[model samples]
Target chain A: MESRNFKRVYVWELPVRIFHWINALCILVLAITGFIIADPVAILSNAEASESYWFGTVRFIHFATAYVFFFNMLLRIYWAFAGNKYASWKAFLPFSKKRWNNILHVLRIDILLQNEKVHDIRNISVGHNMVASLSYIALFVLALVQVFTGFALYADNSDWFLPDLFAWVVPLLGGDFAVRKVHHIATWFFIFFTIVHVYLVFYHDWLEGRGEVSSMFGGYKFIREDRLKKTPGNTKEKSEQPSESKPEDNPKEDEIIV
Target chain B: MATKTDTRETYYESIIKQGYSRRDFMKFATYIAAYMGVETSMIGQVVKSLETTYRVPVIWEHFQECTCCSESFIRSDHPIVSDIILNKISLDYTLTLMAASGHQAEAAKHETMEKYHGDYILCVEGSVPMANDGYCCIAGRSARELLLESAKGAKAIIAWGSCASNGCVQAAYPNPTEATPIHKIIKDKPIIRVPGCPPIGEVMAGIIVHMITFDRLPELDGLGRPKAFYAKRVHDSCYRRPYYDAGLFAESFDDENAKEGYCLYKVGCRGPMTYNACGTIRWNNGVSFPIQSGHGCIGCSEEDFWDNGPFYERLTSLGGFGIESSADTIGKVAAGVLAGGIAAHAIAANVSKRKELKDRNSRGRDNEKQLDD
Candidate 1:
């Protein structure tokens, strides 16, 4: 292996890293408990009804985790405004032309399996790639739906003010039955997302040698020195093409370091 | 030839003429007070209303529907209820019960509407079909026209059954006749909806008794259903509810669990979603309800229940993808296909990485030779 110069780039901030893992754990708990709530398996027990509150306990765990998930999402939204550039809400939205181009480039090489030109210096993203950021945006919207529907359903059985506020959602969507169906189907969406998200993170770790998987744990990524040298000062534009870089075909430039 | 029955007779005279003893009348009042969720002390008020009030006239209208509401009402558990409510209080009009037909019936309805204007109760038993200029007509007048005319003079309206409350099966998807519920068409009036497929006979009787005793509409829920009956879900009061909480469900109708009277949620019970008095006020004179008879609540009391999906399956079938595709089926298939794709892609990615490595090693060797030269 050839020796290569590397620079440690501060990508995910502390709050962002915390949010990611906690959110992942919340998603896992929520999906499992939610599925059970939808179609509970028979738990054979001769114990008295009050003594055997396993299903009730499962529901309680689900609701508790849901509260954590909801508030954590809200905290992340607040951090999007107060945290570092990579953690900014602006990173998730594809409003600018350059962000749109980055999204297309990711779709071409990573998703479409195309033989695209490798501009390693320009392609090395210090934070989330355009596809990832956009997906986070979508997932955030789905999370909001879960919160709204989950609380609305809870309102029927609870007296809490927060759940009561959304009580109108049940009738607005037709009935409690319809609301429960929507909530169940949305759980599957999260499950599908988790499977693909974990797979793609490992895939990127191997393909780019960028510590993509570990970066969320430590808030830093090993980026190539040449890529770091080419980085522009305007941080939000990190996903787009660098202002100074010109295309080069030197194979040595592909040498990645951690 | 109609001899105007003297308005002088009280409901006591009518019940006595129908062979109901004082004991039977008081017992009926107590039963009604219980069904209405009123205090035991309210039974005296109910009896007093029966004795004093000049039996409030009712104008019952039928539209695009089967006459199941009337059938359910007339089959009240006690003979006195059928005699008192149907034969006595419902004097002015009801298509099925009224002996007078044609002009005689129409004249009676008009006369009642005139005489008891702003005092009579309007009981609507079916949905009004609004397509093609009010298609469901009776006595040469559209149901919409009759509803508007009668409702204008009515003190309060009682929408009987799911048909009048929510348009029932007629208002199911792609409703050809444009059948709409009474409340939607008659917007200005305060309408109380008793929304069962054919609301329980005792529940129907209880509503009338409460109205007669209190001289006002009963407290209504968000959907305008009487809170006395619609406040709690059947699941809340179900005998098999403990099984649900314990996660013990009957997998199929004939399974041992089902025979043991386990929760019917697995057998497509709509109990969790249906709010009615079925569990608390058992049908057929408190003898048994559908669940007691080993069947699930069909969610007949809810709005657009026909469109909610299969009667025997949990979860609604997604609309526009044909009628057979449920959410679980679609979700499982989608997850399965995606999993397969992920596996295939993982293999492809690994193979490509190996090829890239081989090509890179060869390029490195070539570079070393160039340095040697």
Candidate 2:
């Protein structure tokens, strides 16, 4: 008989979770409104020009959502500094050799579907895996590009001071037409990222048999008790470095006979 | 080399000699003041400058461009304006306007450059090609050589059109000539870019009046364009802006909506992105512009507008793709393919998941039997 044990670990903080959902909603609004603005749909309204303002409404929604998205991203950056280890900005960088090894192991199991027998217990992360953290950083940069080009395009039409600040971006990027092209293309990058992101979340939940999807909704993840005792190669250094134990010399190579 | 015209005839005396009455002169002065977007009180200042200033000793240079700028300048609604600006300004050295040709014209140009050094306004009407020394030449010297010499001794350089302001069509994609705008070549001088295919004649005259009245360059934007004229986009001041806001657009040039004066955005009007004074001041004496004539703006004033995309296409097609594919098309195709892949992967994952669960159940039953034994 085998014993199966579970220990609930608090992974995502409330602020991190809030940032995720709000950013998702903002992206959804921005994509739809952005497309409509780029190629407006014809509405058959017999009323006077003043009576129907669908295009204007679409643009206003896009601009409003853009502001919300910008501020939400700023809040997430602030949280990265103040939040716990799991949510900290440090998690995004694949700085250590062990972290790189874990990333390769994850790629093999999840993407290539190889080396299923050697499912290293070190691969189990209580929070975002290295891959997800890195992708989040990329998404943050893409969001910034959108804000800059969007506000630059709007600066001439808008009465606000913030949009005016980005006016210099227009000429810097070789004029309005080129900037519009870049802004439009970046919108699709977000859409593609969203599709891949959702699929991977569901796949990871199924593969790990842990509260991956639900952990985003509720901040708890079910971590194995045995895996927590023997810290991963990267984290082992942080826990007391004993003089006699040379775990670093030959990192735990034993495989469970399931 | 002293071409300072021993006769010191100011612009007022010259215009008066050209048979324009004093009343006509005052009307022209007030009209110019309005065109410059200056205060009505400054009309006296403009009139005084014209009466005293010694024509500013202009040397209009032509390079790799059509003479459309000169044509536009001469076609101002006010005949006195064209006459005074072209002839009365002591336009000592212009290839197009000057009666002297050959050695006489060459001598006249050199004389002005020498005599009025640091006092002349060098109005460059075209781009300078830097490839192979230079493709544009005047009187045995390359355009680059002539420009450097003229620019060295000039007070200010006014880039007269899109050709001189940006590289225009000559500097478009795959430019073999390596045509460069004057400002890019000459960095030391204040180069005011009057950027249109050929800027409005009144606007050209207005800039000259501004310099003469204020004794300084007009306030310039980041691109070195006069802010008063280029600050607002055509779409911002356009009469058809209401139509754009209301989601109304002309399907084509000959469509019912176009005839009704709806916005031309759909048929590829660059008005939204283009910043020029076409909508407010208009062209041809405030009579009509491209939009009013039921044609979309080609964005001629914008930098590298020719390479941006097809004149009629609304969106610029993504580069590195075959000519027809735009960003939207490529993105949609990619998304569609990714969606299909995700669906297939999910289905495969489900089938494998079920097989693995069944295998695990059988293994668990074997384990139970072993435990019982």
Candidate 3:
């Protein structure tokens, strides 16, 4: 085993991390309560109907969490402009030629499993890869859809101006039933996205030996010194690059640390 | 030809002429005002309007319908309402109810169109079939021609039932006849849609009385339904709503839950999505609505409700997919495929990584051996 130099780079900002965790929690709560609301379990009690507000409580939680989810997304959108370069909106949207090229590279190496070797360190992303960033963009759009449909359904019972503004969404989609169907199906998409996202995060963490999982929490990712130097514009914190030049004397110790 | 009288009879005079006393007319006024959701303070105003205003001329047209709206209107609980509104109070032409038929009915309709030109209310009880150059015809003229001709001089239009308000059964999927609602045909006029399969008789009466009292269309919702009647969903006002909130749904029609008056949401009730006054006004003179009689609401009044069914199944079915599959079914199948694909990808990733590692280890050993030599 050879010794290697590692540099820790700040990736996800504090607002981004907070947004990610809160958004994840909100989706989990929304999906569970949403499914239950769609097909409720019959809970029979000898107690009077007035005494049992179990379904109402479930709906209340769903509605309240939905507001949190909506506002959290708004905060994230604002941070995309205000946050650091790695957390910028430019990274998510595939407008530039470099981003499109990176997307293809990711598709070949990571998704398709075409090659295990990265021929160039410059192709490695310190922040989100093109594919992950693209998927996050898609997720943002889906979240908007869920919000619109959710609030539109809420409009029927509510007199508040905010929910009422979405009343046109009902007739536009044909009816209340259609809106409910779209909202329900979009939930399954979140489930699918979560499964693939968690799996890929673990895969990348194991494959690259980068602090992928912990980076989300502490907002720092460990990059090899050689790769960090090769990655253009990512070497802004040159003073922070030469922190640890630890020797890989034992592979077992490296495994335990990772 | 019918004589065009300059002096039109007031609703009070018409009701009085129909062998009803002033007291009966007042009772009828109060009954209609309550049903119309008019404020108690406005009851006197309603009485005053009925006394002063001349009876509004009505031209009732039937097209691709079964005449159920007419049947419902005649069977209103208040005999004076049906008797005066349908028979005496200047209902110039109705194919189902008018005694004058053939040329006599046609002449009477023409007379009202000429005399009351822009003052007559056109009540359409059926959908107009647009396919095959208007397949549904009346008196040797196509329904479209008759509708357009009658609608041209009307003060306002009233779409009486689901047949006229929505396309109803005739406009369901693969509608060969291409039946269309009145609102789609006449865009200029203020069309108030009172849309039940056969709207509650009292509701029909109440709308008419509202028009007479207010001398204009009642306040309407986005769907052009009277806000007073169609403001809340049937589920919202339903007596079984507490059961639904409590999650005590009837599993089957024959279950003990059914006997205990549980909510019928599981057995395909459309009350949650359907907006109507069925829960409050009820049918058969407020005797019992469908829910009270232990049958789930079929959502007959909503648009494309005929296509949105198998009336006995819950709303989980996705009709746009061409096949009748529930959202859960499609979602489960997709999830299964995704999970299987992920498992396969993970195995491939691990195998490729292991091979890469072995190659790297051998290459490192070879380089060390070369250095030693």
Candidate 4:
């Protein structure tokens, strides 16, 4: 193996890491509880009905976690504007020409597996690749759908003003049954997303040797020094050791290596 | 048949003339007010309105229906309710109740349509068949024609049951007659939908009494159902809700759980999704509803409920994926296919990576040999 100079770049901030883990945990809880609520288990309780409240507890957990999930998404959206470039809303939306090009590049090298030669360092992204960022955007939309449908269904039983605001959603979607169906189907989407997301994270971690998995945890990723130098905005820091460059030192230079 | 009378009588005069005492009239008013979910303090106002308000002429038309709504209406718990609503209100044009037949009944309906104009209420008992140029007809006129003519000069329309409100069973899958609910046809009118298979007897009476007392349509929900009755799901006020909260459910009709009056959600009670006053007001004067009678609610009040079910199965079956396939089945199949594909891709990736590494290593050796030579 040839030794290559690497720069430890801070990519995911502390809030982004917190949001990622919290969002992951919330999705996990919401999916399980949501499915259970949809088709409740027929537990034959020989004890008095008043003595047991298991299904109610399950529903309570779902509703409670839903609040957490909703607020976590709001926090992530807030951070998208307030946080660094890596956590910015700009990264999530594939609106720019370069982002679209990166999406195609990722499709060829990672998904389609058309290129079997030694991996190109230039193709590796220091932040989220366009595909990943676009998927996150899709997930964000899905999250909004779940929130709307879930709250709309909850409105029937709740007197809270917040849930009441979603009352119009039920009628708009046709009825309660249709809303439940959409909410249930969207859960499958989350399940599919989780499967693909975890696999790609591990696959990229193994292939890139860039701490893709740990970056989500410790908020740092090791980028090749050459790739960092090639990045357009990082030219001012070219003479300095790339490892010594901090995002805070030059907040204006969003050194996104795609 | 009696001809069109020269003078119209107020509700109080009509009931008194029918041999009902003042106390009976007050009792009827209080009973109707309570059923309409009116405040106790407002009971006197209801009595005052009934005493002063003239009986609103009602044009009851039957279309594509089983006449169950008429049956339910006549059987209202307070005998005076049915008597006053049916007999005193100048019911004008119901085929089942009116003594006049053929042209006489038709004449009476037209007379009220002309005489009262915008002051009369049009009560529809069934859906209108849109297929085959209005398949359901009455007195040589299509239901749609009669409905349109009558609705043209009505104060407000009352869709009596699920048949009139949501097309009921006839509007189920592959609706052969294309039975459409009244609201679809008469978009201009203020339609109050009392949607049950045959909405509760008192509910039918309460709606009429509400209009008579308030001289206006009751507050309605988004679906045009009276918020007083359709505000809460049957499950919200169900007697068996405790069992549901406790995770106690009847697995089958004959199960011990069912015998013990456990929740019928497992056996396909649609109470959670169905909006109506069944759990509270019940049927037959608050005697008992379907859930209390050991049968799951068929969600009779909901739109297209017939298409929503097999009546005994839970809500797991998604209509989009065919009746047999549930969300769980579709989800599991998709997940399985994805897992298989992912496994195959992982193997292919590993094999290709190994081959690429071997090619790189062999090429490196070839370069070394060339340098040595």
Candidate 5:
């Protein structure tokens, strides 16, 4: 494999990178603020209880933060339609008959037990394949439900404004306590999925010489030169892409930069 | 419905002879409506029901009960319950109150049953024992046979107190007599239950007023008790509810908290689960019920009041929507999970960054030598 050189290709766009980081930061703020509203810490000893005016201030902050978070989610929802093939739901969902089997195998063997062989990037598919795709969809659904239930509870006391649209969710949930329990339980799932995701992103960079870490943020990765197109950026050095005549070929790569 | 004796004429004459005016009748009507928990506007309807209809020829039955129901009923402050119920309503026979006894009392009961069969109301005041071929007998007739025979042509059957509504103290666990209420013995007639250790006097009166006014039984709960009396749990309307919500309770009967009017929940108050009008209609001229008399509720009106356990012990514990699961407990569980997640992120992020740096540095060193060549 010493002679094998992988040529680079640009796969991601700038809007996609900016949207990903902004949405992540918003979710972090929302989660922290939500917990604080649920149980306000008495930072000062003589402070008033939840019925006091200050508690209302805390809820306002929580709602305002939710507005910004939901706004970013809406933008991401639209981007899925306008973005490139890899960013679309059709691309992310494992739909092909052959690719679908590989996804299921990886989910059971790797996700259940963290199978090291399955961790290899070559074993991962071009699209989301399985685990990654399901994580994003589940997180998205939970975030929407959180907003719906939150508004239902708030509307019970307040007048018809922002909460009117979601007020019907309250009756279906039975009461405020039911909505509260669901929201509290969903936060734990979001936390668990975030932890495993960061681990896999870095693991691929070390053993595979794949720019899996940078391809997400910087939008490009190097492919094997013998098997794929030669990069125009590296045109000064010729013969990176091998002739079809030589079936098995290898070339060295100088830099494995993102 | 001739009422056989034209008792209304003789009844009015006696009430007049007793020196009561007609204005007293109107006042009795108003008082009965309020007691019935009927809306105030329905007072006129009550007056018409009692005045137009012939006094129901009632043949009162007694079996295993202590006769406390009649004692409580006759003392009803709403003079009409006692007046109309006893002297005016044509209560032709009751063993405890009849001036005549033995064969004469038995003759009076049979006379009313024969003359007004299929028309008169039959009010039973006790449970009928069903064990050992009905060993519980009266006048050489078994109580079971007496109840069935009396109820056969009755227009409606009213079980007066807990003994007749439920089995009461006699029906406690390992009940030997197998004392059963009217509903269990008779299957056809419309039955209305008024249950209590001895039901509130007003509740007894209210049940009759509803029957007389509507010409039907009052709306009943699943247990056959009039909904007006048993619809709400005693806890729902208790004056001690604020104390329960504030988590202040009397720890024991002799504790200092007991004197302060704190919730009696810790001291075996069954008020939380028991349903009755004790807090409102109360007993004997709206004076007080057991809980108001420095004793906790025995849940006397509830089914199986005797077997519910020692009256002095608090209920097992309050069970409901997270009233006990404090806000602090929920917060700690959430914080524990959050802290663990953040720590995991910090460790994983550091590992990922270092691994990425080392790989990039190794590639940079190899490229530097190749450039020199």
Candidate 6:
């Protein structure tokens, strides 16, 4: 049996871990609340629920979760500057000539769908590779936009704080009705992306055994001894562990035979 | 109060000069008080007020709008709303109603402003166009200039309809003339905005009555609309609220549901979100509002309401089993299984309110007990 005790690198910080889990919860709550508000599915026809209105309750949940999502976003943005190299802006963009080639190669594959195994782990950093980084950025943008349009919709009859900030967008898309329609449609995008995102997380976790899911909450992960220590082509990752001994330049290619 | 008394005497003397009888004046007083939403007991006060106070000078300006406000004012629900508000009070000048033409009409308006200075009401109907130096001009004076000059001397400005309030439909997208609302231009003067495609005649009269009787503006909402008249959403007092709650919305205007007087939201009614007195004060001498006339509320009273959306197509967020997610949704259903949902909602609301009250009382008692201890 493989010994449970192994060298574990502390990759994700505590704030990052908390941010990940809280964001997941907030997304789930927001999604459920959003769909419920959009289309209230009645399970029992005869039963009348009167104490709290469905719209009111769903709206309360949506708004509360939105606050969580908003705070998570703010902290995440802050962490980009304050975090380690792996968790910072350098991790998010394709910079090197090798990665530029990979981006083009990946773009080709993205258009012509391929299995996830075909992608090279050695060619990229750990947290999020170039493609995944941009995808994360897209999601971040979507989340930020969602907060804006969400607040605008909420501000339709309420406080001016959100409305004043985003009032210009209401007129940009024709008028209030169009703005409302765009907001309603954007909600569906977030929902669809979230479904795919959760599925991918579980699939990758089950396949790679990299402990990706657990790392988000626990802030550590176990890497194989044979795998490249300095993120393969991405040598910038060397700063993380100052004391770990360098692997032999050419260790014999050994397959694990438990 | 003295200003009111003086205005009242002035009105009595004006009518008396015009050879109107005391009985006619008293009859007009009762009619005006009732239409103004004053109780029958207040008729004596209205009579005393009108009998004692003079008619207020009014300079009515017309711009990029139909003079429906003046039409509605003249055909008001109150007999005096027309007589006292328009011809009888002898409004100093209005473009549409005034018999004088060209220089005479201009001279009369100028005379009212120059004489009354700060006492006359400036009733503006329609939007002020702000293209060129204002291409929309009246008697060689740009509508903007005329509005400013008239407003400069006025005590209060009453934006009579949606046109004056939010530029109405004229200020919608691609507005070539740059129609602007009255308050947007006049920062110094106090304005009371009465927005509606054409406001309910009685409501228009009521606002005037409140101003005249109270000798001040009526209590206003955040939107600068009179609270007594514009407080409740059209949905709140709508006759079809029961139908809406019962989930019996009219699928289409020609459907059986429509015939049975169901909620018209599915067919483009903005009633659920729009606040106005149409559902209560009604229109056409208390006979009916638009909803009663088999038309969905157009939300003509709200800001940018003209551009909000098509009148039909139910709001995505508003419909469905509204109570399904409430505190007692499931609990109340169980309560109904034991009794009935009707009883459950009532009992649950009662129990919840009771608990709330009890908790509040307990907290208060705890504070008192703490002091005693």
Task: Specify the highest-TM-score model's number.
Answer: 4
Every prediction's TM-score for the first chain?
A: 0.86, 0.86, 0.87, 0.88, 0.74, 0.73
Regions of candidate 2 where Cα sits further than 4 Å from its true position: A1-3, A229-258, B1-7, B344-373
Docking model 1 quality class: acceptable
Instruction: State each model's C-alpha RMSD to the native.
Output: 6.1, 5.2, 6.3, 5.0, 12.2, 17.2
Give me the displacement of residue A147 in model 6, in angstroms. 6.4
Kindly indicate the candidate among 1 and 4 with the higher lDDT: 4
Show model 5 residue runs off by greater than 4 Å.
Answer: A1-258, B1-14, B317-373
lDDT order, best first, reads: 4, 3, 2, 1, 5, 6
Order candidates by DockQ, high to low. 2, 4, 1, 3, 5, 6
lDDT of 3 by residue, B228-321 (tens): 8988889999999999988888878998888889999888899988888989888877788999999999988888888777687675567666
Steric clash pairs (candidate 3): none
Error of 5 at A198 (Å): 25
Pick the lDDT winner: 4
iRMS of candidate 6, Å: 20.5
Lowest lDDT block of 10, candidate 5 chain B: B314-323
- DockQ-based class of model 4: acceptable
Per-residue lDDT for A157 in model 3? 77
Runs in model 6 deviating more than 4 A are A1-186, A192-209, A213-258, B1-54, B88-90, B132-135, B213-216, B219-222, B315-373
Q: What interface RMSD does candidate 3 have?
A: 3.4
In terms of lDDT, the poorest run of 10 residues in model 1 chain B is: B1-10
Model 5: CAPRI class: incorrect
lDDT of 3 by residue, A1-258 (tens): 463456777767889999999999999999999988888876557888888888888999999999899999989889988887677777677776666888898898889888735466556677788899889988988998999999988998787898888888877886676777789889999998999999999988867667899999998887777643244555665333222123342222111111
- Report the lDDT tens digits of candidate 4 across residue range B1-373: 1124646788889999899899898899888899899999999899887777777889999999999999988988998989999998889999898999999889999999998898889999999989865477788888888889999999899999999999999998799999999998999989999999989888888888888888889999888999989999999999999999998988899988899999999898999988998998888877888999999998888887887776787755776687688878989999999988888877776665665546656656766776854
- Is model 2 an incorrect, acceptable, medium or high docking prediction? acceptable
Q: Evaluated with DockQ, which candidate comes out highest?
A: 2
lDDT of 5 by residue, B1-373 (tens): 4454564654344455556777887787788788788888898888776656666678889989999999998898866568767876678888888788889888888888888888888999899888864557788888888888889879999998989988888887678989888898898999988888798888887787687678788998556778788766676677766555444556666766666666676566777556688888777798877766767887887676675555665422112424344334554566677667656755654454555446556776777667855
How close is chain A of candidate 4 to the true chain A, as a TM-score?
0.88
| Tens-digit per-residue lDDT, A1-258, candidate 6 | 122222355678887777878987887888777655543432222323233244555667788788778878889889988986557765676665645665665444332323344544343234554666677778888887787777655654466575457645643443344455556556656655655456545544543456767877776665544353555433433234422223452232221110
Better of 1 and 5 by DockQ: 1
